[model samples]
Target: MEQKHGTPIEWLMPLAFCTVFGWVVWHTPAFILDFGPENQQLAALYARLDVSPGLAPLFGGYGDIIDYGALLLSPLIFIGGVMTVRRAPMEFESWRAIDRVAVFIGRITMMLIVLLTSVMIYEVILRYVFEAPTLWANELSLWLAGFVFLLAGLYAMQQRSHIRIFLLYDAVPRWLQRVFDVVSTSLIVIFAAALIYGGYGEAFAKFMRWETFGTAFDPPIPATLKIMVLVIIALVAIQAVINLISDWNAVPVVHTAADDIDQDELERLKAAVGNEGVGELDVTRGAIQGNQSEHK
Candidate 1:
């Protein structure tokens, strides 16, 4: 399929996400330094808490210190969601820029795998070879894992990879399917709204005060993860809305067990593997055909 390129206006959501996440990634070193006790001015500028109406008791006695990381990431999470919602829903095989951003996110998140592996390898060397152990390795890996797991939801939503019960759904009438879509999307939006609204004060307080996980490698991971969750949930809801709008006029499709198999998949795989003479695998006849289509 030919890919459609949108105008400058359509590029805004993606650009916004890139800008915000980019800022956070770039400023991370400074952010960490800002939280250090030696840097009073930077700390004050970045992590000073708005003490009024704070949920101080929630943090187990640490007075509120603003969460710079969460604050920085909030815009990325939001703009990422907006970008997802703005994306035109495409088939799984079709490549588009909107989908490319999700893939971009997925690619970046793959860094966690590298981080986890590197951390474990370093820990092994430290413990076995150097006769030392570091608390930071495990915790840092855990921290990386948190973002990897959480950010995956956005990618899955873009790919429409979430598990669904299609037995009844696929067989429904077009109007009925639309109704189902509306109800489901409405529930998701409601849940996201409630989560944000109900937990706003709590998240705000935690992030505002720079709450720690209380480990030796004390990262503000908890605060950042919580905010990330809220942000992603809102984004998922927005994507659902976009899906509904995009799919509302579509015809309902009924699928049987047989429809689950696609013979062309094997052909594509063979082509990918550089098998020049490989032909389409005819699943029904259980044979490979020289031509792209099966002989009737």
Candidate 2:
């Protein structure tokens, strides 16, 4: 399939970077405030600072200014996200505007997973081969993995690839299918709202304090993950609504056992071992035979 060239990166990068820069400043205020004051190695770095050694949480007295700055910068994330989706392939026919946001987040999370793997590999090599381990690598991996898990949900929802038993759905008529979609979307919205309503206060508190995981590496996993959970759930809910609207007019689909098959995987297997090897494989042969007869 041909790929769509979305928005130019020249524009997207600067817009996305605005949010990234603001997030860095807002989320890791200690970096600019009074970070690691107890570490002797960082003493020279601290001494050169124009600000005081022990100040408020986020830039001490300048917290209000930083807050306003971050608020102003946060909207750039949405703008960048929308623009980035111009390049995303509409994998499903029912794709909609909200799907762009989910796909954008999913792409970023996929990159984070790659970075997480590299971090783990680097840690393993250093720990076993060099007999030296870093304190930050493990925590960093955990942090990235958490966000990956959370963000992947939104992507999965957008793709309609989440766990679903389509046996009943496939048997239903168009009107019933629409009813099912509405019911499921409503449940998702309710669940997301309940979760956010219950957890918002705590998430906000942890985020404001930049709560850490309290370990040698001391990452802000608690603070960040809490906020991410609510954010991802809200996105998932929105994507569910979008799916309902976009798929409303879609013809009723009759899912089957063959629907579960991964065509790309079969092709890859054939390429890897040639057609003869694929034919000899008993595992997939039955499914292929069943699919052929079903299609006939």
Candidate 3:
């Protein structure tokens, strides 16, 4: 019999790239001090973190952590990505279709967050300490930050931790909740699909020509990365479709009073006052009291 789930071959390239990149970075001093915008920002951050003279070496080595950590995680992410693609429920096939896009966007966002935060610090230090500013700092920050801002939506979808109001949702009946989930997820998928279809051509063209930020700090990082943004948008679109499918078949379980108010609630109440209530409040208490009062 054929296997129910099999690993995808597409993950190998990224996995290999991460492994080789990590090893070279770990071994080479040149890679650590490449002086490109990305590395410069990273180095500046390290310098700031070095408060004590003795800690300077440790702080300077922070870039290696990023390099090695990415190296280590890349393979795992690849494997997981494969598993996610292969083992993903048939009902959730839409997720597989768009998984790459979500990952690409998430990676870009994280890189931007790091780059911007570092450059902002670098600029502040230059202005305050040296009484001089660098053009590279501002340009670098903007370039990196732009990429990060673009990726946030993809990351939010991948993590499934996007903000949503759940307070009123608890009161919704199970079947209706499922319907709500399907509708919401479907809408997101539609929006993402539209974005990908409209934007992918331009994004791909940019990548094909090898566009650059035109900065002095480093060699042109390929515009191929921009393609990742398109890919991620596409993936998120697929994920939304899969989520809608999965949720359509899901049976929502009603939560009990105890679950509604737990230790966290007790802590909040205690912070507000000094005591805990003796028992859970009856949700139907007002109705019960009304019936008894009428009979009396």
Candidate 4:
């Protein structure tokens, strides 16, 4: 099927995400050093967030997610959502900028999950085997897990991995299916818009202040993540709009139990039973299996 991805300049969105990612990672230590009440410039810039317990907590309702280490990612993601109709080509070889960026984010998220798992394994070994538990592993895993979950939604939309209960809609006429698509996309847009409107003030406050986790690790996971939620949801809404317009004439995608079944797995299971992996017939019936070429 044909598709459309408007304008080549949409590369700006991915650039924003990457640039902020690089900036935050680079200047984290400096931001922490300057993030204090005495430094009027940094204090006013960072809002009411303190890196450690010595500082006062003002306008800090979130966890240890507001540190200077990871503050710029939120804004980068918001920039990624600036264009409501931008989309990636369906083909991997012909992917556009947004498609590549989404894939890049997905790979990073996967690495984070792997890192989280490794930390858990290391913690287990230290606690049970060495009998010396560490303080940072649990918080570290929690921090990575939060971003993994948040970013997974955006990747899912890019790959069309979302679940759809299509029983009624698939059975309906093409026109009716189009109507259902419109209604569903409209609901998603409305929900995302409502969340941004309600949470914008809080996210902005946390972002401007650069809050931090009160724990010993004290990473800036909260403020950045709060900002991320609004940004990613807006991205999701914009993707829905793009899908709504681009797939307007898409054919009904019928799904069934058989569709969900893995044919290769089924064949392997069939072979383990000592039966030749032929279709629907018994050897005891004295019927020779038909030739594969004949069936074709």
The candidate scoring highest on lDDT is 2
Report the lDDT tens digits of candidate 4 across residue range 252-286: 55455455445567667778875555555432212
Q: Residue pairs in steric clash, candidate 2?
A: 56-60
* Tens-place lDDT digits, model 1, residues 2-80: 3333445444544454445644533343444544334454355333322322533223322223334445565666555
Per-model TM-score, in order, reads: 0.60, 0.72, 0.49, 0.65
Please rank every candidate by lDDT, starting with the best.
Answer: 2, 4, 1, 3
Candidate 3 Cα RMSD after full superposition onto the native fold (Å):
12.9
Q: Which candidate do you rate higher for lDDT, 1 or 3?
A: 1
- Off-target runs (Cα >4 Å) in candidate 4 are 1-97, 273-296
Error of 3 at 158 (Å): 3.7
lDDT scores of the candidates, listed in order: 0.61, 0.69, 0.53, 0.62
Clashing pairs in 4: 46-209, 47-209, 64-213, 65-220, 65-221, 65-222, 65-223, 66-211, 66-220, 67-220
lDDT of 3 by residue, 1-296 (tens): 11244343434433444445434432333233443224554355335432232422324544345444555666665555433433223212224344554654343354447557877998999999998988678766665555565567655665454676667776888787877787787787787778778878877655444345566643223454566567666666766665566556655533434433445566676677654453333333343455557999
If ranked by TM-score, best first, what sequence of candidates would result? 2, 4, 1, 3
In model 3, where do residues sit more than 4 Å from their true spots? 1-112, 163-172, 213-226, 245-272, 276-296
Candidate 2, residue 175: how far the Cα is off, in Å: 0.6
lDDT of 2 at 25: 38
What lDDT score goes with residue 206 in model 4?
Answer: 70
